[model samples]
Target chain A: MNYETPPLLRLCNISYSHPGTSASLLQDINFSINREHVGLIGPNGCGKTTLFQLIMGLLKPDSGTILLEGNAVTKSRDIKKLRRKLGFLFQHSDDQLFSPTVLEDVAFGPLNLGLSPDDARDVSVQTLEQLGLKDFEGRITHNLSGGEKKLVALATILAMKPQLLLLDEPSNNLDPATRERLIEILRGLDLAHIIISHDLDFLAATCTTLYTVQDGSLQRCEQKQVHSHEHIHPYGDYPHQHGT
Target chain B: MISEPFSSGSTLFHCSDARVKVIGGTVLSLVLATTTSFAVAMIGFLFTSLLLLISRPSPGLILKRIATVNIFTLFLLFSLPLTYGGADIVQLQYFQISLDGMRIACLIAIKTNGILFCFLALLATSSTVSLGHALERLRLPRKLVFLLLFSYRQLFVIHQEYLRLHRAAQLRAFTPSNSLHTYRTYSHLFGMTLVKSWNRAERVHQAMILRGFDGRLIPLKQPQLRKSDYLLLASLLLISLILAGFSLNNPV
Candidate 1:
């Protein structure tokens, strides 16, 4: 990594509120990501996903600048450039994998990058093979098993060969075996990614840095502080560790 | 779960190019629909039936589908003879049945069945994705094809969402009945499903943009038309031309 180069992504004083609402969903979110795996966690409705949407230009920030590779993203063209460098894996695999077949869905990003159909297919095939899904090319997207659909959805993003990935709940609905496979794949990837997941174990295994969004603010959480401890619930005398 | 059961096969129709099948199916159906002569209609029906047989769909499924279509025609069969006025009439005690009306109804039933069999043999043998690509290649509007392909893809998602909502309601002891409460609950369930689907659509759109999707959906593979496909197309056109000639020569 060149020290002279700027961070891969930078956000400055970012704030956002839903239209027609008084309260802000996010406020003064400042962060920068280098070539490193980052994990973002928050309680439900804490604006973690909204932060990602702002980064990806899906939703504009009310006040702030989003920088991609040292350039300010202030226009549609700049957003497009940012998008070219960033691949966002949606929370639901069903939403991400819209094409009929696995190959088509995987090829979609490459084709949009202006590759010819044959070349796009070649890249899609290579991406699938890299992810151990060589035989899934002809499988219908909707008919795929939950685990298979998740892998294929990841493949769709990976086919674009982005410099960074924004993954939202990649391991949400996976079985144990599949989740293990996902962890292995994520650990093996060389590209930087920011994963938003409630599964702390999943984040601990795959991400180098963890961040938490609370009360419309983003703060870094230390890795050493992510240990499980016995705790009692208000409704029961039994004590158990979280995520047991 | 929704599925395209007929899309997987190795028969001639299954192996044929989707564009050819689309063209052949359209021409044959148009011919069958427009023809008025019984002779042409019967020949077209036999031809489509033979195509259906060659495609090798499950006999039980084919019978069920044909029966479903014929059920509607059965209404026509019963009512047309009584309602249609003609010189040639069969007198019953309280009503008169027109022979021409009966003939025309039978012709329509034959034509409808012929078209149905033709589509099942051709269109259903290929996956809807390939069919959408074929339509695009045939110079259909790109937006229309996109609409068709997207709608087909989203139908299952929307259905699953609806089922999940319905299951949640069921878990809450909400039983659907012929009552205002049931109706209200059902409407709320449907409305929630729509809202969820709308949000999912927005997320999907964002995902697409994040992955650099432009306006066009380019297909990865462009299926090539082979000799067999050309032969199929030629034979279908020849059959259609023959049926058209028979109809023109012997008008109803």
Candidate 2:
């Protein structure tokens, strides 16, 4: 049987809704991500986070299949293979990191994969070193600065060396210096990525293509074209909800 | 100096066959715990401590873990002698309590500290996940085992929320105070944290169901026991038995 190699991630007519909520929060999320540094932008409650959760396998679609590398991503068995191909940097660093120390936190994913204790430990140290966070190896994670915690979270995923990096709000809670370091780190890593952020400048700087979540659907926008539109203001009315 | 060996270690303990750790460690602890012999407890403590040391966790980590049960010891050390009555050196006037407190306090401290120390030694070398598995192997109910697992997951997530709350408070202008007003604010904060946690838990449960996580968490691979692991278990039981035998006879 000749089977075509699957794309990195594909959502075919995917839709989901909360149990009691009548409205479908996400519908027809039909997009195939292969090699673009895709920036997903939308106002709060516009299904941006929901899309992320679907990709991360934390939430499943109510009506469609989300595939990783051409394989269905529904099974726990598939998640191991899918996770090997995708690294999800959760928006909340605390949720991403549950371990007590820096090294242990970084090692969580690899150890979960059943890598022997010695091998997992080695990979964690190397990942931390590559991120220039060698000094943070033994520090208690709770004492870390906002940016440091984010770096640690990213490192936790980086250790996995996934083909597609799924990041949620990479610049949130970061100082400019740390943000720059993170941006550089992301730029240096050669992998297909889906970065979700509200920061227009960050999207403009790193993304080759921008996809905005609007009206329960994600629409890919034309590159180098800024339409005259009311973008979502952080502290004001959200753009996606305002428009339809 | 901070070696969080427990947190970073494999799903080995988490995914390991339950019988391996629970039946293994508990039987070991039981043989050791009920034995009132000083030699076995001391030898078990030393032997278990050596095993933990070989895990390469830092000295500070070991000490910090051992220190957690000190609260229980504090009560035993202070009140045991007074309540039980120690040597008659000092006596309380109002309630007529005598001061044979020192000797009784020593006995209680040693006894309590010894049991605690033995358990610490076992846990230091083993993971709780392994212990949980051991219980399941010993025919503990599946629902109870899962409840333990779910609560463990909840505890960590709740801890994360607490950190966020504390950080938010620190960022705000409000100074920490012991006044009634501050205490009221603290209660309010605690209440908010609980509400937030419940909402998150609800979301997580839905997510779990969506992902087809019905009651059981059948791991991809099963745990296999090696010859050396049994050797280690055997030596442990032997040492525990000897310690119990000696301690009971001596009662020191």
Candidate 3:
């Protein structure tokens, strides 16, 4: 007998539309990921977030099948099981962090997973230490700077020890130094992740596979294709790369 | 901005366990509120004032807070003596002043100041999150604790949203004045803020579910009450009981 492990995540024939809308935002989308760092890039409001919501089971797809580790995620219990192995980081760190303190926020997921208070706290401390946030345990969540909040938000997910992470706009609104630090952290992580960002350079530095959502479909793009291009400006014609 | 200026100190009140402070503060406030004896109220006021001093709050801020509370008491002092009816009446220029009314208002003012001082000394020393956790440990309703924690977290977000909207209005050269246009613009700004907050709440709820959040929010670190915390609680309770006893023996 021959058998192989299935993909980490699989979406087959997925389609979704907003309520009361006739046009589908995402249509006939089929994608799969397996133990590889992936990057997803697209324009604003092109259903990138909607696709993530479907994957996280926040919104039910109009027509589709989502498989996590070869198990179909249809029922609520199945979705809960899938969530145990999948971590979704929101685009807005403010929305992702609801706890008043850093340690509490990081420990939230572990506590929800039925870990004891001591074990969850230990996990939270270790996660924060891994992220170079050792002294941030007692920091107020609302008082953190933008970059610090983003890193703390990532720690909250990392504490859960999920198999795959889905990070939405991880590099949004970060300063140059903090963005560089984030890139290094993402590259150092051993688990697989699908990062959604508008920063092409960030994607190139962190992801091994690149995908773009356009025209309601997911398409693979070559790294070589993301090169400098000439464009006409009001002042003059100039060559510039994306995300300059 | 809602600032917790007193929350970052290293005084005894700050170092004590939040649960101890919460219980002590609540008990003291209850005792003071129920007491009608002038002597008991004065003693409680002095005790709370000493506690506030030991907490080592900035002198200026503490004075400002006391001043704000006293403003309302000043109004009571001026109005109560003239309006309240009693046997001991004194004739003013155009009204009768009741000595009993004056006594009652003075008692209320003293109790109010005492409670305020107690709250500032004990409760304000801990951050709101710690207070919520302390309340949870004290067997308060889980939903109420959640509501307090979540609302405290979202207050900053909502405040920031409102500031952004106000900034946008300023960029458009909108100015406030006694005019219908200004009122309309202010209403629109408030409406937009509410709508944005509603949307953000939905997104935050989704994020919570994605993290496998069940109905309960478990606190990670449960602070143990140390010997000092126990000592402080015992002292406060003793003071409260003594004051209650004195008030019962010498009722107004």
Candidate 4:
């Protein structure tokens, strides 16, 4: 594909495994992405989420170069700077919304970024409003429903105004309406994003391209191939209603 | 899992500034700790009861908090009298309990329960975010406050994670048994929990770092103390002084 802008994120020769384990979880992962929405689909334990941790510098690849906007992310200091440009949404919203109240949680990033408390709060409020969560400001985070928690978690990241978003299972446990809302929200964002989800229809609605993880390697997936794959849902027949 | 369940109430205690509550509660706990007389402890108990009556917290929540604290307090009942080895206050054919030990134990229990009830009425009545803000306002170390918030958030998450794993095991026909297999299974479960916990912590740290979080956590709001807050603080201090005077005069 031809592009006018340089890739927002670039990974080269990335490989990693848990210490003392011989099997590599991710091997020779070469990838680059820009502002276009991308989807990552893979079976459980196929190193999809591990790739995200690597990009965020939570886990380091044994040998590789990761560049964010052309800056190296090998050192802790460099990772610190690179992270601000990227937002990672964990597979579990419970892991992300650590602050007591939705407003506090959303403001956490801005506060850490050295914005004054008032400014941080303003940004949080705006972000929550953008996500249609204006009434959740004083609500305790844990009291939120699963879908609400997901939106709040995303709001916390969006409050940072990141250049790129790394979303893992963004549609994991949402009701159909919430999933539709999430799809619309994802579609509306102007920033680049790499979303990992098993919900192919949801991904089809929001993502411009798709990649499949197989045996520790990422391969570009054809649109037609994605629809043809036979998969079984453990929770009865897949209930997702796809747009024609 | 302390519930800030009463935070939304329109009660006077709920509306009072968190900083005032924090400072007043600390001072009161200090007084409770220093009281050398049972009379002072009794007054502290009375104060706790009054606070409880006004706050009007769920009786079940209060009982739960007391039950949690009693786990540690119960140890004193067994160890205090035997360890002190003083003059026997209660003599029996098989064993004797020491008077000084008995006195110390009772005093410690009163002090603990008094402080705990005070905490429930003051600190627990406000949201944790407000409590964290109150700590920041009081100029407590920012890193310490950050750690406090981090732990508070993770406590429930870690607990729920463990419960989920336990439930998964139960679904797989696993049952608690006094056997090596059971011990090994539990050990593995604990080890997995620790690994998952550490991984979760690392991810949370990364997420925080992404938002420009340095080592210090900045307070999101700085609520101002109102006139009512000062009034409440003054009343609390005055009562504390009167209680101290009575305890000083009427020694146990």
Candidate 5:
């Protein structure tokens, strides 16, 4: 099968490990993603998170190039510029929701981007409204429900208006209804999104293509098409791409 | 870690801004320094209290918070008269109390009350973020200002963590009741909280770095100084000056 030429994010000969840690977290890894919605499924303790960070420019690969829209992201300055085009949601909602209120928290990224205060507020309001969180503007982020907090965290980055979004466990710990709402929200967002989740059904519904990480390497799975109907959840044994 | 909980957003705290609080408060404090007379400091204390009330802080709540931090001040207050004797104009049933000591105590109270009251008005009314914006407006070192801004950011998180740990400790089935085990548990928690905070700090730092947080506090759209703000600031300075002048000349 012929794949599309040139991806939104292309990782070439990428390898990374924690700077002070004894062992390498990921190495000899790479695959390009042009798919609008992609899934990165893997077991616990794998370098799934590290790889996401690598792509977000949170961590630098020890050796190799991470080219974003054809520009190498090795230097700190370039990484800063590259980051403006990417929105990242960490696994923990508490890590991202630092502002006193939900609206301010969501507006954080937009504010950092130097958007006019009025414009930032509007963007944040619109983003939160999309997540059914318009009523929670004055509410403190810590007071929100687990599911609500996750959505609020996503809104914070969404307000930044990034072209590429990187989400870690977008559906983790959310109730079925909340998770479903997340799926709907994901479906509505028009951008290049890579989600790291253990929820297969959530992934199957929201993503157009899927990739799995095994033993710290990223491979292109043959299954790139969305499941035909929403009647069944994808779990257990299915065709998975072997480690490349 | 950011310095304060909220950066300069449109919270109730930002109305006055930090520079006005810092400079204006400092100028107000000078009048207290010039005079030991009760009336002069008393007037200063009153203005500060009025500012605190206007900030919309519950009087009881603000007092309770102020009291907790005042334990050390209380200690200092009690020991102040020791080894320093003054002329005694009145004698109690058993001991003669020095008039000078009485004067000194009064002075201390006035000075302490004035400073604390002013600071409370500054922080509780003006958001920490506003203070940062105020600092930036004042043309301070940009690097220092940014460091302070980030430090202020961590204040919100640290305040939350302190609340969390206190709750967790309270919820634990057994209270240590001032035993070594209690001390050990508290110490353990302290270490744990530090480690957790450090990890969080690292993650936040990474996030900040990704956003091009060069060591500069970029102006969040230069906070415009409106006419009313200048009016209030000028009036406050005028009040401080008059109070100082009257206090110094009063032959009480």
Candidate 6:
């Protein structure tokens, strides 16, 4: 299938391996994210996160080009400009919330994007309030509950108002209510995002398309296929349909 | 439980601007460090103790902090006197404690306690994040300020990671013993902690870059100093100057 307009994000023949090692972590990865929330499911170390790093221009691929809205991110300046339009939510909320307070953390992205301090702060407050975290502005990040930290981390990304979001395991460690809140937030979002998670129910609820990584290659899974797949949990061996 | 002592108070020192508190605390510590006279150092200790009393941190916490410092101070007090070859203060069968060494040790202990009490009363009275911001506003190197902020946020994460790893080990029925395996297991724990920390740092850096962070972190709004801040700084400075003048004029 072909489209007249360029995709929001396009990856062309991306491959990567750790330096000084020949075994490839990601090989010949190609995907386009446009008008859909893409869910990525895979085992640990299956290069889902590497693909994200490549898209975000954090890791240099051994071969290929990353195009954000059809423009190649070759130069540092180009990456910087492109990065402003893309947001990445790390798997660990600890990595995302590095600022001393929630307000500072949320405002960090806007501040770096050249907003004035007051304007950045206003944006931060609005973003936090939108996420039902208005009171977390002055809260110390570490002192927050696990669920609160996850939302705050998402707020940091949303405050930047990116065109594309790359969320790594956004639903991990979230309670049912918090997870529902997150799904609601993601559903209401107009931007395209590729969310990497093991939570099939979470993905089925919010994502329009799904892909699973296997043997360093990405394969798209239809909604029916995703629901029928066997999922594992630490508590018991059970597989149930998500009914997407 | 994680909250710092005196960090939530609205006392005079706590209400003062962090920039003033940081500079005042540092100056007082420096003055105490440089005072050669035992009497002047004791005066500094007394001054810091008075400040601590006024600030009213938990008495238990203050005692615990001072006791922790005194463990190392006790080592210095006992050992330094035997090393310096000067006038004999105590002649033992195996060791001859020098008068100069004993005096130096006393001065060192006094200075140590003075500085610790000063920090507890002033800098520790406020949140460390504010202290970092104040330092940045005071023209401290941006890298240093970033380090402080990063450490303040990441240290807790690292500690939690460590505890998780330890719990995992315990779940596997691993117990510590004085053996090579125990040593190796501890080494592995530490090595894994470092590896996890490095990976976390890389992810954090990636998240930063994804949010359009260039090399430099943009500064937030500068804190405004209130009249009370100025008063606190001035009074602390005046008291330090008088003590300094007295110590300079009459060197004991």
* Cα lDDT, all candidates: 0.89, 0.68, 0.90, 0.85, 0.73, 0.85
lDDT per residue, candidate 1, B1-252, as tens digits?
357878889999999999999999999999899999898999999999999989999888889889999999999999999999889999999989999889989999999999999999999999898899899999999999988888887888899999999999999999788999999998899999999999998878877877787756787877888998999999999999888888889987
Off by over 4 Å in 1: A1-3, A143-145, A173-177, A222-244
TM-score of chain B of each: 0.97, 0.71, 0.95, 0.84, 0.73, 0.89
For A47-151, candidate 2 gives per-residue lDDT tens digits of 888887777777778898887778677778786577667777777776555445687667656666657667878888999999999878888776788899999
Can you write out model 4's per-residue Cα lDDT over B1-252, one digit (the tens) per residue? 545676768778888999999988888887888888998997898898788778888888779879999888788977898778865667767777787887888888888999888888887889886788688878898888877877887877788778888899999999999999999999988988888888888777766766677777667766777899999999888878887787778777
Tell me the deviation in Å of residue B82 in model 2: 12
Candidate 2 per-residue lDDT over residues B1-252, each given as its tens digit: 222265344433333344444445566566555554445555665665554444445567657766776766677666755576545645456543545555545444454555554444445445444455545656688788767755765777787777788779878865778799788878877888899899777765543332234555432223577765576567657766666667677764
Q: Residues B1-252, candidate 3: write the lDDT tens digits.
A: 368898989999999999999999999999999999999999999999999999999989989998999999999998999889889999988989999999988998999999999999999999887899899999999999989988887888898999999999999999899999999999999999999999999999888888887767777767888999999999999999999999999997
Off by over 4 Å in 3: A1-3, A116-122, A132-140, A143-145, A222-244
TM-score for candidate 4, please give it: 0.78
> Candidate 3 has which clashing residue pairs, if any?
none
Q: A21-101, model 4: which lDDT tens digit per residue?
A: 999988999899877789999999999998998898878798889987776777788887778888999888877877777
lDDT of 3: 0.90
The order by descending lDDT is: 3, 1, 6, 4, 5, 2
Ranking of predictions according to TM-score: 1, 3, 6, 5, 4, 2
Question: Model 5, which residues run further than 4 Å from truth?
Answer: A1-5, A18-24, A224-244, B1-22, B46-59, B62-82, B87-96, B119-123, B141-156, B159-174, B177-181, B215-223, B247-252
List model 5 lDDT by residue over A79-190, tens digit each.
Answer: 7777888888888887776666787677667777777778878888898888888788889776789998899888888777788888899888889889878888888888
Error of 4 at A52 (Å): 2.5
Q: Candidate 6 — which pairs collide?
A: none
Error of 2 at A129 (Å): 2.7
For candidate 1, give the docking quality class from DockQ.
Answer: medium
lDDT string, candidate 5, B1-252, tens digits = 332322233533357556666677778877776776788888888888776665566557667767875775676556554434666656667655567766676677767777777777665455555667777777877777767766766766776676688688889864767799889888887887787788988877665555445554444345666776677678779988888888878835
> TM-score of each candidate?
0.90, 0.62, 0.90, 0.78, 0.82, 0.85
Q: C-alpha displacement of A63 in model 6, angstroms?
A: 2.4
Least lDDT summed over 10 consecutive residues: which range in candidate 6 chain A? Answer: A222-231
Candidate 6's fnat? 0.70
Instruction: Pick the winner on lDDT between candidates 1 and 2.
Output: 1
